[model samples]
Target: MFKPFINTLALSTIAIATPLIIPIIAPAHALTEAQVLERLNGIPVFTITDDKGAPLLGSAPQKGSEKPPQVLLFFLNPDDAQATLTQIQKTNPAVGSKARIVIRSMNDAYEVIKKNQDKKDIAFQIVPAKASIESARTILTSQGKPADKLPNVPVFFAIGGKDKEQGLLTLEQNGKQLVPFFFDQKDLQSLIDRAKQQQPDVANATKIQVTSLFQVLDSMVATKDNKPNPDTERFTFVPSRNAFEYVVKNQPATTPAPATKK
Candidate 1:
């Protein structure tokens, strides 16, 4: 009887080992893109907190209340965060009443927000970064990016509600339609580096012509199929082209024009 029991135990061990010997297939996620989109569309809220840990948007929209278009700016580096905030202020007249500007900031963003909170030009809010990262990751994942690939620093997005008609959905500059693009500090730095190499005069100039700089980058991308490839949320967007244009037109000669690329 002991011999029989030992044999049965051995057989059971082998059965478990056999499966392990083969490659294990990872299970697919249950939610499809359509399902995810449906759920997201229905829940158009990004739950985040203020520097004080209070809800950002009053917990939730009043039942059946209409949602506005939201322009979100995420920064990796604190230094760059201020630039985004300044740009929004410069562009408020053009972006007027279209949508509210929301900047994602770490707990550290509190002081920065306090400094500029009195500014009346921009309709803006500073949201806690920790509370917003997961939502950003969810969006990134939906765009086909792995969670680990998410940026540690700063990025920006202009999110629209399911109903597109009521928000800052599209931009028109000299008749060309513009879209929002997501990019990191590295991408911006690369553009600046290349500009320095190819056009040192412009790079070294006291005041950079943002329109000309943007034109150069646009030409480079136009030749190639350079498009923002986000993995999670389908943005149908581009970087802050309008904001740059606004800054160039509104700011004084000393203000550095924003340099960004696709």
Candidate 2:
């Protein structure tokens, strides 16, 4: 019943047609706002919205006030977003019936938060998929680190080297070597599997590292004034496969061609 409406909404606002793993080069100068936004453009997030395209909000109690802060949930997985919408539908059919999934770039959400930095009544939170979080916790525990301290929406990367000296694993695609940072642990595992097949020499040395999206973005911004190294790696962001697949499947349809003249 909601398929037509979903398609309409998708066609109207879906700017991304496929999952993109964009390579970002470290600049010689400090990262500019434009640079950060450009890097963020390649990563997509999902959110549920009404027919009017407004995100649903929830409240949490404030630190020292009777009023609570309104939080806008940005999901890393389309399934998680759908699950949330389903719960809403069960609890309140009126809003659920009109709600639809909205695909948006990470930059879109960043801009929203940036524009509202001065506002005290609202907050924006990126909700990581539960499976991803569990995988992250397991990784942390295996690394002898406390799993409870894992950051929200952790990004994973693989590195390989000998004698405690390690470097990020690079994959060759389109004849160019690129480093990939995955938003989902399962995706990283897939990459690890591929690495073992393609680069057997370094496969055994591979080690997983975890970091948050916020930390990476901040590091990029903070490196604007630093000197650029010629050997600096080009980093690629691999969004969650589930989210990426969802966007690709529902991409806007191509317009029909006009009739040819006789």
- Per-prediction tally of clashes: 17, 4
lDDT tens digits, residue span 25-132, model 1:
222223332332232111111112233333222222234655542222323323344444345446654433232322221222322333444443222332223423
Write model 2 residue lDDT over 150-248, tens digit each, in one string.
877688877776654556666555565556678888877776776566556677667778877666555555353464433233455677777777877
TM-score of each: 0.21, 0.79
The C-alpha local distance difference test score for the whole of candidate 2 amounts to 0.64
Shift in Å, residue 34, candidate 1: 39
**Cα error, candidate 2, residue 56 (Å):** 1.6
Q: Which 10-residue span in candidate 1 carries the lowest summed lDDT?
A: 7-16
Query: Where is model 2 more than 4 Å wrong at Cα?
Result: 1-30, 62-65, 173-175, 222-225, 229-233, 253-262
